[model samples]
Target: MSPAITETMIYDALRKVIDPELRHDIVELGFIQEIDIVDDYVHLEIQLTTPNCPYAENIVAQIKRAVEGVDGVHRVEVERACMKGS
Candidate 1:
């Protein structure tokens, strides 16, 4: 059997998704939150700096793409929320 997916692996994958405006990865930007894994499925929330961010859709797509690249990940479900106090 293939190796099980871990939070570390997921985070590593997420590091490749860069916020075009910030030119920085979401992991470093601390936007990733509430990572939950079940079997081959992954669920996570992304807290954007602003609710009206123009790039939100693109960012979510990138996040799905990145998370799906993990070896054992069969599905990725992403939710978006604006950061508190933002």
Candidate 2:
């Protein structure tokens, strides 16, 4: 049996996803807004610098790939997090 997927593992996987313009891992930039394990799927919320950030699609893709590559992650869902009070 595979080890259960924990939030730490998810965070570790996300470290591999880098922001091209910032040249930093998305985790370090605090882009991971939320993480929830519902049954076999992992739901993730990513906070972007802005609602209209041009790299939204690409960054999301990268995050998907990174999180899904983790051993016990059966699925991944990504969405943008709204800015505080906005």
> Against the true structure, whose TM-score is highest?
1
What would the TM-scores of all predictions be?
0.93, 0.92
Best by lDDT: 1
> Which runs in model 2 stand beyond 4 Å of their true positions?
none
Q: How high a TM-score does candidate 1 get?
A: 0.93
User: Please, what are the lDDT tens digits per residue for candidate 2 over residues 44-77?
Assistant: 9889878888888999999889888888777899
Count of clashing residue pairs in every prediction: 0, 0
CA error at residue 53 for candidate 2, angstroms: 1.0
What lDDT would each prediction earn against the true structure? 0.92, 0.88
State the displacement of the C-alpha of residue 78, model 2, in Å, after optimal TM-score superposition: 0.5
Give per-residue lDDT, candidate 1, residue 47: 92
